[model samples]
Target chain A: MSRIEVGQRILQEDLEWAKANSLLFHKHRVGCVNMISSPGAGKTTILTETINALSHDMRIGVIEGDVETDLDASRIRRTGVPAVQINTKGGCHLSAAQVNGALGQLPLERLDLIFIENVGNLVCPSIFDLGEHAKAVVLSTPEGDDKSAKYPAIFARSAAMLINKADLLACGALDFDVEKAIGQARRLNANLEVFVISAKTGQGLDQWCQWLRRLVSQVKILGQA
Target chain B: MHEAAIAEALLKTILDVAGGQRGRPLAARISCGQFAAVNPEALCFAFDALAKGTRCEGMRLQVEIRPVEARCSACGRIWTIDDGYSRCPNCSSQQFSLLPEPPLLLESVDFEDKTDE
Candidate 1:
């Protein structure tokens, strides 16, 4: 009996699909951001606020992923941007294949930016690559700053982190240490960019929008190059 | 939770590589980093359940977990860390980059060749 050596990735098929999706985005010159967070971490709220803040200057589309409802998609549609809802039917996280199917329904040519609101999960979603140019994680102050330490995998892979619900901290309703959160995240990912914002109060959103604009412009430039 | 999906992927990968090779898979060696957050027990359970009808039915999944390694850009010191708030043990710099590597990988597969008989 002879033993054969096969050295490859177990998720090679998924990785290939993710790479193809990325190429599709590049071909359309659209910047895609995969947004992940724990349930009730204000992902939908922050997404809506960000859409309202930048929809005029930049054309935006959204792919909402949920376990059972299209409620988030409806909210995004109210803001006048195209939205596609993907109900996973109890699936823990959205997979690359699912995202590829959703991309077909989106008007890629008309959108400069597409935000994929991943399943409200901090763990499983972090493990999958959805072909997004950047991964932005929302961590609400109410969820506690220790989450960065608790879920290091997500923090390590995120390109940018939004410390949402800062207003709650301002009112002393929540005791989240923003400094410690940023420190922990940075320790895991030294290049991670941290932004403290409150979606309800429109606090610190301008900078977030600016970063989005820059990312879109950079993607456009890369497409040209 | 996602271990099922990972196991399915593992099965698909093994089958694709072992494609009509005339042998059943005996074992697979996989490597995951501390930051991968994979539960080995859960993955094995899922793999065993999913492999019921596949060629990997009784295959063994050997997982190797590697510690998270970082190299300080400032001091150029390399260190392995188990905690999330990893600082270079030598220079105590927070400004270090994680060693570039895939968090999870199927390093190799061992399959017995049945054609020899």
Candidate 2:
């Protein structure tokens, strides 16, 4: 009997494919962001708002991921941007392979930004790299402030955290401590950028839209560089 | 939940590496970081379920969960943190980065040659 030593990463193959996918985006000068959150974190709302807000200046495309329905994709399409729906049919998160397939369907040359709205899952989605240039997590105020502490993995990996449902702060229904949430998230990831916004009331949408525009421009510059 | 995906990847890697080998894989040793948030038992169970009727059937999964190591940016003190806390235990500073890099990795694979026996 002989023992063979195979020291390698298990997901190296998937990661390589993801890297290739990223290269494809870079070639097209497309800035992609993977947005992840829990089921009711208002990802669709924020994404639709961002698309509407940036539609005039930037061409946007979306790959909506969900377990069963294409409703989110429909919502995105209503905003006059190209939208593709990926129904996992029970899978928890969207894989890079799936996104690679979706990339073929998108009008890559026409899009300045592509937002791959990951399946509404904080844990599994964070684990899978979808070849996005940036990873963002949306946390609704109703979901409570302790989520960053409980789900540190996603918070740590995310480049940006969008605190949605900020208008609900006046309702007094939730004891959402914004400071604690940002503190815990910063502890896990010191470089994490936090944005407090409400998708429903559009309270802080302008800042979020401006940040996204800057990211798109930066990506374009980097591609040229 | 995501353990299923992780297990499938693990088995696929073992099979690909053990290509042309005349025996089923006996075991695989994987290294996971505390920051990875992988449940060892769930991963094993998923592996067992997915390995059924495959070449990797009955393979033992040896998961080595690596504790998160944090380095204090202020004092330069390094310590292993198993609790997923980012703060340095020595200086109580929140500014630190996890050490021993690569969050999750498959360190090695162990297989027995049944044809020789």
Candidate 3:
């Protein structure tokens, strides 16, 4: 028997879910950020610090994704903001459908910004579209500047990349080159916004927070219709 | 593996196509682009395991990792990217775009008709 040929997309439903999430967020006037990076890249710390800095001015919520445990959600809650924990059960990344469900658990009308802390993965997380207004990557100094080129998939897709843990570079012990890193990233994505920040020392967080404020305001204006 | 979900999606898509048709699925083809985070081997394994005891069982799966194609925004030259991206081979312009396409796709599915004896 001749083989029947049918052309289709396998992840069509998932893509639809992501697009729906994006539309829902836009309608609600909420800015969503998908934060992705390697494990131990201080994603939790960055979240806590960013929440502390901005929670006073705007309403912020979090969707924490991890392989296991609700520790990050607990930390985010400590800042007095709502956080929903998602356990992937060893999954390497967060799916848009999962975040769609988590979005329902938060106070959407009261929230201006929502951050989805993707499972600490530089690779798999980049492929999934959570329908965020912006996709940001947090690269710590120790993970090396070479990562951008090595993992072009993520750097290429990210709208912004934060070089985190700048505090470690103060001692001149780590041989990470900040300029080289940005330069490498630019080769793949010239418009990519680069921020050299330390969540521990609060070095470049002002600019980071400013970017968020801008994104939130833009969403506000767009959602006014 | 991270491909399990993707594989599951593949299975579901196939079932949707095979619903009304009277046939046992024979094979399926997938194209995994360079930008996709999927590992072809892992995807195949996951699909095989998930398809067991299903109508799509014993379906041959072919996953090909397509080379990345980038276009020079200035010179309008498009070429396949063999390795890490840096500059255009023709113009050396860093201003280029990785031709936007889906990172992964189930390109096609092959089904066989069952004949009444």
Candidate 4:
């Protein structure tokens, strides 16, 4: 018999279920950002800094995914921002279904940004699309420039790239060629936007903040009645 | 690592497509491009794990890994290699080469309906 090819239709019922909760979050004019990176690349630290800087201007919420710990959610709660944690119970990456479930618990209507901090891994998160407008991939300087070469998919799929730990450049053992990393990333995704900053020293954060502001503004404009 | 989640996605797709089919689907053909970074055996095992209690039970999954080879406009040579190689096989020219990313796609399912006779 002749073969028929079909497009990838993610299980509809499951997807619909995922959005059932998240759609309400968007109804409040919230924009979600899925931050993915390898473990110890400093995702939590970066997010903490972001919240600290923008909390006053923007109402932020967080959805933290980890193998087994409420530690991250606790950290976010310390800042007094509404945050929910989803312990995958050992899953490597967070699924859209899991995020959808977590969103129901969040106060989405009052939020300007919803950040989903994914389980720490470079591979699996690249494959699953969590229905976010943009995927931000974080790469630390000490993680090495070769990281992009080894894990191309993560960098390729990300709409924005954040090079964190810039302050460690002098003392750190790793020699990162930021330009080369950016070039390699562009080779894969020509439209990829690059941002180099240290979540610790706060170097180069203004540009990133500007980028976020622009994205939020665009979403607002698009959602206008 | 996320094989289980991926397996779930694959099974769901199979069940949805097989719903309108004639007899129970006996086999499914999947085309996985080299760039997809998916292991066929792992995928098969995952399929088995997730399909046990689903409509995809007892169905055979046949995965075909498509080669990532392209003709180099610079050297005019076509070569087959793994997903990692991006430079031209003959001239090592990145400019005039075409690289194919591995894409995962469900090709078709096989079944027969006796009631049509």
Q: Number of clashing residue pairs in every model?
A: 0, 0, 0, 2
Question: What are the per-residue Cα lDDT tens digits for candidate 3 across B1-117?
Answer: 669989999999888877867878788888877878678788889998999999998888898888878888889998777776657889898787777855577777777867887
Q: What's the DockQ for every one of the candidates?
A: 0.68, 0.60, 0.64, 0.31
Per-residue lDDT for A1-225 in model 4, tens only?
434466564344445654664465456777778899999888998888899888777988999999998999999889889899999997988888888878879877678888989999998887766767688999988788877678877776788999999888778577888898887776555568899999999998888888888878777776675
Q: Is candidate 1 or 4 superior in lDDT? A: 1
Residues B1-117, model 2: lDDT tens digits: 889889989988887877868776788888977666788999999999998998898988888877666677788998875555556777788887656445567777666767543
Q: Per DockQ, what order, best first?
A: 1, 3, 2, 4
Off by over 4 Å in 2: B99-103, B113-117
Candidate number of the best DockQ:
1
Chain B TM-score in each of the candidates: 0.86, 0.83, 0.86, 0.74
lDDT for residue A184 in candidate 2, whole number 0-100 = 80
True contacts kept of 1: 0.77
How high is the lDDT of residue A111 in model 4? 81
Give lDDT tens digits, candidate 1, residues B23-110.
Answer: 7778888888777678999999999999998888989889998898788888999888777566778877778888865557887778
Clashing pairs in 1: none
Clashing pairs in 2: none
Comparing 3 and 4 on lDDT, the stronger one: 3
Q: What's the best-to-worst order under lDDT?
A: 1, 3, 2, 4
Whole-model lDDT values for every prediction: 0.89, 0.86, 0.89, 0.77
Error of 4 at B65 (Å): 4.8
